[model samples]
Target: MRRTDLSSGARTQPPSVDRAGSGKAGPALILGAALLGLGLGAYAIERIIPRRPMLRGRVIYRDGDYEIRDYPAFHALEMSLYGGREDALQRAFERVSGADRDGERPAALLDPVMQSRRSNAADGDDTGFTHGRWSVRVPLSAARAADCGFESVDPRLRVISVPAQRVAVLRFTSTEDVAFGINRVMLEDFVEDEGLEAEGPVFYAYYGLSRALPFGRQHEVLLPVSP
Candidate 1:
């Protein structure tokens, strides 16, 4: 299976092993061992790594990995990705970390960076995406944006205030494109079943750093809903 490095937004494939020898017992044993290893690794990562604070929100409803959350208006650094996804992510990170601003204090990192597709009007297919947008919540008040001392170097980058919203979210693991597509379908179905009116396009929320293994990583599909 392939996994993403959340820090860099890079995909990595795990090493494959040959199971030709030792009969059917070999494959079963390998599977069991892999499961055990993953379990142990997840536990270790949880215990050893200090997690970053996630954007605060109140959960008003919950069903398995699905939830309706009420989030307060917050400030976020956002940029449109017209180029490669990886390159855009790296540039955003550099700006967030103050690597671009010499001698300045880096902004506090937050969990669950949000990304959404930017559809071209010419594209007939709703599922077709031309580019994307990436946004990361910053520890700053929307009321006092100027005090934050954050400035955008790229024309596409800007600091914006996201209004308070009621959102329906579907939580899942794995960074695979198929996983995202599947969850989006499930989330849309859930919204329809609940009779909720979707107010915006579907966006993805990615949590934690790349140090987290694929099994332990967290991803969410979120859609704004009418109150």
Candidate 2:
């Protein structure tokens, strides 16, 4: 796929991975093993890690239907994804979450972008791969997140309200990167368990980074409430 790495600072093209030429042994095996180990290591770190207080927050705005919570680090995390792709959101979660295998949900974390649709069917973007748009709005009083903790509010805790509604939420553990998949599994389980029909994509928010020191990141997956 033609793409650029927009994870870090500026966007840059990444070297393509050639599948055919990778059949060679020696270095290929080593590289593959190295990558496997790296993935496993990340999983391990997230599983065993503890949590820590990152910030306290509350909902600041309601977008006709949805509420927005403002966190100090929200901008840094949201902007990491060039597009609102679920894969990108998962990676961002993993990067920010400081947990190990024991407490990480690899799915459920999602980019809150508006899904864009083709104006005409002939546009040929029918794959629906990039159909959704990712977006976030800062609350008017978002800067007060830090103050909430001083008034006895736990910095590690947060709340979001869309008004006049409640949602069924599913929880799990994972560094943000893979939270989406885990969330998906959990959501499916919830749906089957409760026999509730879904009207659309799930709703949610990223709460404290972690309960442990540096490296801990946490968030929640929320489903929209139906009347």
Candidate 3:
């Protein structure tokens, strides 16, 4: 018979003690509750605030991803930025925000924010490298446009009128970061069918940008025109 020694060096786990379960139970519930509270708080805030009315133009004609419309003219404080897409937008935001003159508040300009590239010179570098000539146009109400003056010393940043004109509007749902590989065939077909001419650079408008999910975000590509 072996005698049971109380002062044995080896340790033994207690029977059915459930140490693992008991140890985890407290922290798991705490973490879960914390996460749940945060989610609820965010949802509440999202519901409480009113969303902005995204940019839109009257749809005179409509087809899938293509249409022709007469966009109303409006004034905007605009600036030309150079570099990658994100870089350009950041610079524009800073310049516009720094305006100490009218202490202007921007109407978020437009959705997806307008981005355009300048034409390379005929004799200029045909090299693979090309810099972006991105422009940001923040449209202003006629009353506000008249009242507000861009006093920024930056010559490139100035307020101007976007003359009311027609455009070939192409809409799609996409994240703003996607490369704008426009469906050239569809657009060209639209132009031919409508007997319209391409006049100026394309304007990209955005909607539903405030939503958290990137999927289903609305984007519109506006090609300027003479007709």
Candidate 4:
């Protein structure tokens, strides 16, 4: 009989392919490449850029990376933050720069941002979140005539007058986010070896963006000492 066979006449269809996974993967790869390029470019810019002149201080003693410097009295904008170091730094920057409030005068940005760790014993609970203070020197013009009362847009920030003093400093360069611990230890060892006593908590001074390349960034662990 000439009757069409239903099975033979049935249309064959190709298997359906799921492209959702591959579609996402393509964009992710592109984004990753873009970010990598951006990071490299930033590192390059930092390397070639001329740094703002650091606040001048006389070197009292020098021993390789370790030194004793006599710094003059200066006014600084200081703030405390309790969380990630990056977040803390950003918030502190905004506060000091007057970007957080309207009609607030921005403080002059300066080299060598300073930082100090806050003791967790006072808080009574170690949540692993970072607790620290960040300080940046502002232009002398920003200081009030009466006192070191530098106006800040954020109440958390205040202007403090630092007295002229001699500090034991251990300088190093690194790419890590926080190099205070190891550098502090080294400074302490150097101070002890030199028969010097630490008069205050160890704080850090950074001369470059936190994200700058290791070679382009400079860090110092500073311990106030009896002069």
CA RMSD of all predictions: 14.2, 18.8, 6.7, 8.7
Using Cα atoms with residue i matched to residue i, what is each candidate's TM-score against the true structure?
0.66, 0.33, 0.63, 0.64
Give the per-residue Cα lDDT of candidate 4 at 119.
Answer: 45
Judged by lDDT against the true structure, how good is candidate 3? 0.62
The 10-residue segment of model 4 with minimum total lDDT is: 137-146
lDDT of each: 0.69, 0.41, 0.62, 0.65
Worst 10 residues of 1 by lDDT: 121-130
Which lDDT tens digits does candidate 4 get at residues 128-181? 225544344332333332343445346666767778888999888763554656
Give the per-residue lDDT digits (tens) of candidate 3, residues 41-136.
Answer: 767756764454444567788887688888787777788867755566557766764552353454434444565555442345342114466777
Q: Quick one: RMSD of model 4? A: 8.7
Clashes of each: 0, 50, 1, 0
Instruction: Quote model 1's TM-score.
Output: 0.66
Residue 114, candidate 4: Cα error in Å is: 0.3
lDDT of 1: 0.69
lDDT of 1 by residue, 28-89 (tens): 89999999998998889877876766787899999999999999887776666543333445
Q: Which order, best to worst by lDDT?
A: 1, 4, 3, 2
In Å, residue 66's CA in model 2 sits off its true spot by 21
Model 3 clashing residue pairs (backbone): 111-206
Q: Please report the TM-score between candidate 2 and the true structure.
A: 0.33
Q: Where is model 2 more than 4 Å wrong at Cα?
A: 1-132, 137-161, 209-214
